[model samples]
Target: MKKNNTFFYLCTLLITVFLFITFTTIFSYFMLREGNKASAIKEFEVKEQEITLKTRDKLKIRVYRTKTKTIEEMDIEEYIKGVVAAEMPAEFNIEALKAQAVAARTYALAHMESVGGNGCGQINEGDICDTVHCQAYISKEDRFKAWPESKGNEYWSKIEEAVLKTKEEVIVYNNSIAKDIYYFAVSGGKTESSEEVFSQSVPYLQSVESTGEEVAPKFTSSLRYTNANFVKMINSYYPNSITSSSNLKNNIKIKNRTSAGGVKELQIGKTTITGTKFRSIMGLNSTNFSFVFNGNTVEIICKGYGHGVGMSQWGANSLGKNGKDYKYIISHYYKGVQIGKYTEL
Candidate 1:
């Protein structure tokens, strides 16, 4: 009887051990399979999210935010959208906005350092800045805050569409990314050549007719400065240039005019200054300006708003209103340039 009882106990112990091993194997197999399935699902979701937000040109740009004093990395397309929104008026025609989008993209690509061009030298780690020195950029939140409550979304959507439509388009010259891609607010009925404004003769940045900009707000602006103040300001920049304010008309004369009707040089007393420099010193609107002396106060009238080089924003709007497409406007302003994808070289 004792032997039979011991045999039964041993058999029961062996059966329990076998069952435990079997159960553990089955549980581990199912757990592993479920874990793998969950991982696969998570990976697919991540890829889908990437596909939703990722642009074809995944190039990143590092911008130094002047207000926040932080370097922010963003996709190039997003940067262009912000630039177009901040640079051009949201009320501008869609075609003009699209041209601005392309111009901004070309400028950014030309200055990008990751692709072998020099980045913005203002900061070490940044490719550009959120200022006019590089390109004005406004954050979506700030842009929305500045817009009317009802029109914020509508305006932003328009800018986004402009950028999306002109994706990856850049101005090129001779099968290469063009240099000195510039754009400004207004022109003096015609665009200035790169040689006249920047002192370099770029083939693509030649003089072109830019009519219909008279409707712009600052197309004809005037600023008054007392004779004494004008002489003081000019002397401050070019010391001892003008001796007195009595013979101001004779002392300050425009030496030559540019092809586009802007002042090329000005003779102020013994100092001969370029119109560009004088404009900066006197805080005038543009190089295309004239002075009127009424015995005491000198009123400087300017016919444009910016340097008068490259594309004119107001002119572009006029062209767009006249049924010109973005491509036509771009080609009109920038001569001999091809609109295409940016060349890496």
Candidate 2:
């Protein structure tokens, strides 16, 4: 009987040990599975957050196609790619291309009708137009066609990389994106102040020296017209003011100049007009110009390629080539500004 009891006790002890081991193994397996599930959930959340941030940064814009007279909505990043491709030379430095991309983005955002701003004035149905009146935009196909076949792909890849690297970046002033971030082809050695160019004062659009524009092609242009043709053109616009070429020669004068050396007030026969107006009427390349009337022809010499306001494209390229980054280039031209991500606003 004692031997039988000992056997029963040993069996009971063995069964208890086996049951404990089984329970501990099952518990550990379940804990590991739960831990893995939690880890996966956390990773998924992180990915979702990343996706949300990307979506927020994706800006949409309405573009008006001048050729088709149609309005199409597109991603602002893509629009900026087109604008940078069309506006800046593909051969420009990557930093210069990036600067152009930011300026173009800021300009577009500032003029967005959905943000309580006026459209680009080229169309009623779109926020901006694909012309110089707003921003020059070129389709991918047209851009490729504009370049040499040998260099087209390579150049386009550079522009695309620039645009993507600086994606969602814009210039900001006073806690807001600059609305009138005007830019031009050249500056005639100096940029003009806002008040000097547009008759409206903007603190950020201050006058600044722009070097290296002299190296640009077409930096200087001369328009020469016969005295008779000059008089006819002036009279056609002014109407019955200049009776003869002599009257025009004597009456035409530069009344004053802006601080940046741009023509300010131009005196004509019995009418004084701003240099801005004169540029528009005469189709001059820029307001930074001089005029000389000789015996037979009137020669108008322009120093720059566009209105001497805000950033200069050639100047930016020069700066970039001289080891300046895009941020420095932007801040140099636009006084008292900061570079920030658009989504931050």
Candidate 3:
């Protein structure tokens, strides 16, 4: 009987050891599975946080204030409102204002690396400046001060409506924001091709006829300067080349003209300067100019204003007044571009 009891005890001990081993293995498997699940959850949270941060950056714009020498960060849409108010005239048609809003929004996005750019850190760690160098921007208070007290509310409401209507809309070419969306006050009967004006070939900025720009206030301007003054001006640009009025008249000639009738190349003594450069130096309204030097006086006739490239604000206003919608206006100026909402960076 004692021998039987000993064998039974041995069997019981063996069963206990096997059960312990099995339980331990099962517990270890479950712990490893739980640990993996926790790791996956943590990774997902990190990805979610990264996306949120990116979205926040994309939604905001950093503006550099030139006067105050400071940086201001604000919502992109709000920034657009300020730009539209400052860039376009308050009396402009609502559709034209909307078009300006879209263009400004596209320009801002194109300059921001977080949104999609090489990064336009123009000033003070900001994406853009509040001057014409980037885009003219006025704060709410300044905008109010710019207009008459009675018209301030009305104009501000009008601009706000336009901006909100075209919120987040941008001009896109080939599934990306257009690199350049240039706009000027007026065109000289025709818009200039980008290659002619900026010396850069942009496929979307081809020359196109823009009528009704004659309605602009300064469509044509005449600058009368004495031969002595003309020579002085030219000499400022090309020093010591033109000593006398007769020398200036003899050396100054148009070497080449663009297809749109704007000056392409001009010869100033020995140096050949671009028509755009000449216009800038002479303070002419546009590159489409003609000069006549008659003995003692020189008179320069300039047509239109600004660079004469891209959309003409005056032309846009005319089209808008004629019942053309903003889409039609933008499409007419920018060739073969899609107006689409930006869904992502």
RMSD of each: 22.1, 15.5, 18.2
Q: Enumerate residue pairs that collide in model 2.
A: none
How far is 270's C-alpha from truth in model 2 (Å)? 2.1
Q: Judging by lDDT against the true structure, name the best candidate.
A: 1
lDDT of 1: 0.87
Candidate 3 residues 172-250, lDDT tens each? Answer: 7776678799898888889999998888999889989899888788899989999888778878878976766665578
What candidate 2 gets wrong by more than 4 Å, as runs, is 1-58
Tell me the deviation in Å of residue 250 in model 2: 2.0
Alpha-carbon TM-score of each model against the true structure: 0.81, 0.81, 0.81
Q: After superposition, which runs of candidate 3 have C-alpha atoms over 4 Å from their true positions?
A: 1-54, 121-124
Please, what are the lDDT tens digits per residue for candidate 2 over residues 1-345? 999999999999999999999999999999999999999986464223211112223457889999999988898889999999999999999999999998998898887776655687657798899999998999889999979999989998999999998877777777677788999998788899999878899998999999988988868988988878877887888886677776457878899999888899988776788988888888888888898878888899999888888999999999999999998899899998776665522
> Model 1, range 1-345, lDDT digits (tens) per residue?
999999999999999999999999999999999999999986464222211112235578889999889999898899999999899999999999999998999898777777655788788777888898988999899999999999999999999999999877887776666657899999989899989888889888888899998888899999998999989998888899999998888898898999998999989999998998888887888999998989889999999898888999999999999999998999899887767764322
- All models: lDDT? 0.87, 0.85, 0.84
Residue pairs clashing, model 1: none
